[model samples]
Target chain A: MARSTYTLTIPSSTRFLEDARQFVETHAQEAEFADTAVEQFKIAVDEACTNIIEHAYKGNEDHHIDITIIIDTDRFTVRIRDEGESFDPTSYKEPNLMELAKKRRAGGFGVHIMRRLMDRVEYRTRGNVNEVRLTKFRNAEHRRNGDQA
Target chain B: MSNFSVGFRSSNSIKVLDLQGELDAHTASELEAAIQKCQDEQHYHIIVNGRNLQYISSAGLGVFMAYIEEVREQGGDIKIAALQPKVFNVFDLLGFPMLFDIVETEEEALSKFHDAHEEG
Candidate 1:
């Protein structure tokens, strides 16, 4: 599979989240993501980065978030790796959406939304380090030809 | 720590939060903390006045989603008012209107809250 990758290390802050999203969106723009997919991808990156800033760094804004963008003709894969601790996002149960809708809870829904938006989501932890990988595939071949699908 | 300002006030039994500037991943936490404070104080009839809010990313939505349960558990609700069309479109696309009672003005939200309180 032909792939290209770029990695960045930055403090676990929202600024980094913007940079990361911009990087992904800019690269993905070549494929022209559908408006909904663009929005979803932006949301997924924001949530993942927020998790790194909140849970991984534990409010310490000094640590770096190691982010990798893997691009291919068929899909874009974003991998977020942090050294803070071995935390598995997959272990976090999908909060009941029925209850979520009834109650309007805010925080726990990020991972759930990310899972919903991405084509593939995997989480693994090793040696006290956590990694979250999200994949989104390009389906609109018409858009690839610069035609809005 | 993202660039934004957040303030809260109470008017006619409605707690209003004024969020200005960008509400993205970076600045959503500040809003979250403020909302939590209101919830912690048992103030559930909340109104988010976003007239000056320029943008709201998914990260921002995550914060509100976090508090959905807290407000409802108290027999209260969170209402959004004066969302810019762009922001509203995002909310609409994400189906926030179904989850929240989004209104066009602070006065409207206040009236609704008053009506709900009276009816209950």
Candidate 2:
């Protein structure tokens, strides 16, 4: 069962990504997640926010991003909402590594990294807001150890 | 705010950059400027020392992708060395090892440049 929820709101700007990452790291640690898991969540959240700022908002700094983190005993979920352009995340494709290397592509890596780091990633658009939800499950053994500690 | 800074050095003809702190969207431009400075100077042989790089995002990784082709076309390459495991995982996940030469030490990267120069 989900025990608590934390929310943060920040401008749709790249400058706030570090703050967002720190927020996730602190909460993940308090939840007794492993260091590697914390790092993965940090990267995953950062990539998601970056995509919102750069692609969804089209580099507009005046927009805002609302982040909600839900914590359960064995899982962590993050929902990011932005009032930017509506786009289908399912349509986006991870660049082919072989082609990326041959052409030396500079972008299109953010979505790929986000998907790889999180256990589940889903996106939807409701009305004028676009939401991206990411979830990561804690290891069963690790959670049992954390419960004892 | 996340901190990021770059230090430049020269190993003979090779330009070595020591990256410190976080490399994300906010600070990626700083790296881009440093790479531009290298291009302006025509110092194509480049090595990025990531021993002090604590964190990196895709934006930071993009900076390297932006200039690699130009440097390689000029008969030089950008090699990364001493990447902290966390940083390396990001690159490795993206299959960057096949695209760029990532070594265990800065000395190894510098030596590879020397070897390539001698062969050509």
Clashes of each: 13, 0
Give one digit per residue, the lDDT tens place, for model 1 in A1-149: 67888877778766777677677677666556676676667667777888778777886888888888888878888898888866665478866545765565555656766766677777888887789988887764523233344
The candidates score, on chain A by TM-score, as follows 0.79, 0.87
CAPRI band of model 2? medium
Error of 1 at A74 (Å): 1.3
How far does residue B94 in candidate 2 sit from its true spot (Å)?
0.3
| Candidate 1 chain A lowest-lDDT run of ten | A140-149
Which digits, one per residue and each the tens of the lDDT, describe model 2 over residues A45-145?
A: 99999999998899999999999989987788889999898768768887876666568677898888887777778888999988998888786544322
Candidate 1, CAPRI quality class derived from DockQ: acceptable
* lDDT per residue (tens digit) for residues B2-116 in model 2: 4999999998999999999999999999999999999999999999999999999988998888888889999989999999999999999889898889999999998898888
Please compute DockQ, using alpha carbons, for every candidate against the native two-chain complex. 0.40, 0.69
How do all models score by TM-score? 0.70, 0.93
